[model samples]
Target: MVAGILMSLRELRNIYELLFCDGVIVAKDDRRPQSQHPEVQGVTNLQVIQALRSLKSRGYVRESYVWRHHYWYLTDEGIHFLRQYLHLPTDIVPGSLRRVSKATARGRAPVAQSGPIPRPEGQTDRQQYRRIQRLSVDKLTGVELGSKPTPKPG
Candidate 1:
């Protein structure tokens, strides 16, 4: 599910880049030729419309009509989303696509050390197993097996 969402977001980002960079105006018709823009190269008109609709629902794109034809363009929110997606600072315009900053890069968060986790002193595997066994069995019966007194249930 997550992978699908990511793939869709990537496709949407590509479509946004094509529209913004190439000044391509997408129409409502699916019969139109695929985009020639490098970012959206080979992508069908239907796929582009779907991406646009998704973006529109997320407030990233807006639709306008001229005469009887519908056209799509990026909203301010859409531009902001694209900027953040590209890891470029909010202040920087996307016109210079090559320019990016390392501080705001969308890299993975820093992971903690990968060394073996330390166990509490005096609690070996055998002790831990016995503890778990006692809890699991005693809780169900309200008494520890082999014990003389019954535990009061709360």
Candidate 2:
């Protein structure tokens, strides 16, 4: 249980940095579809953002922006707490993305490359719905849910 929590904390740390930085250093570069940022070895920027928001709500960081998008940046208290918990250097910058894994055969993460291609925005809601339904998972009782998930049909 402790191990799981620690792992989650690390994930939150990575995400907090990623979102606060706005995909500038950790997210994939738009021009080079072939190149990915070095911070998260296998995880996508979206996953990191989600984890950060989850941690934020629990007060591990600060407010979530509460999904408000009005403000970001770790509180002084939060930075202090996180520095101790994550054992980070005192001068750590806001936009840093630490690579947690080694490169793959293609020099990018195998897992990151495994997801389906992104759909164009012009796709209709019904088409998007069907695509999501096709990817839906069975509801499991022990799992926690994210707030304001991209809604799906019940």
Candidate 3:
């Protein structure tokens, strides 16, 4: 029973990623080492497709046609569900959730911020969203710091 629930939750997380990212461009966005392909490696396009089908049953995600490829996005209900799950501020609607691939000398489990604790059966979507958000914030913070404040020319 626990395993079944966990499986469902994993699918849910995948759906969220697809929806949040506005559907990963199958032919563009070549930033990762695995970006140049029919699908990104490690990220597993099949897993994402499976998750999309599963979440379609829940009516939270929908597919759209853009030229020759399909795009994914959250329905209003889906967005609402994410907001509730993440306990986000009433005014904080997420813009997007892009995936980041860190090239570790060896694969390491990426650390993330603590959010709403999981339901023991491994409800990982909220946690994963928090993790993604934290990473984005950290990246932006680094960029901000790395950039010079500005030239104080007299």
Among these predictions, the greatest lDDT belongs to: 1
Whole-model lDDT, candidate 2? 0.49
- List candidate 3 stretches off by more than 4 Å: 1-18, 21-41, 65-68, 96-154
| Candidate 2 wrongly placed segments (more than 4 Å) | 1-13, 16-39, 60-71, 89-154
lDDT of 3 by residue, 71-130 (tens): 566777877777776555656554544344663424766668698665546547777787
Model 2 / residue 18 / CA error / Å: 5.6
lDDT of 1 by residue, 1-154 (tens): 1212333556556676666653335555644554433336555566666666677788877787676445776667777787776666656554434454554466756566788656678898788878788999889988778879857899
Q: Which candidate model has the greater TM-score, 1 or 2? A: 1
Off by over 4 Å in 1: 1-11, 22-24, 31-39, 67-69, 94-154
* Each prediction's TM-score versus the true structure: 0.43, 0.31, 0.38
Show the lowest summed lDDT stretch of 10 residues, model 2: 22-31
Evaluated against the true structure, the overall lDDT of model 3 is: 0.54
Error of 3 at 95 (Å): 2.1
lDDT of each: 0.62, 0.49, 0.54
Q: What is the lDDT of residue 38 in candidate 3?
A: 50
lDDT of 1: 0.62
**RMSD (CA, angstroms), candidate 2:** 21.4
**Candidate 2 residues 1-154, lDDT tens each?**
1212233545556654554443222233232334433566545444444455554565545432333232334655556665675666877744424333556535786565666656878887689887676556324333334535456789
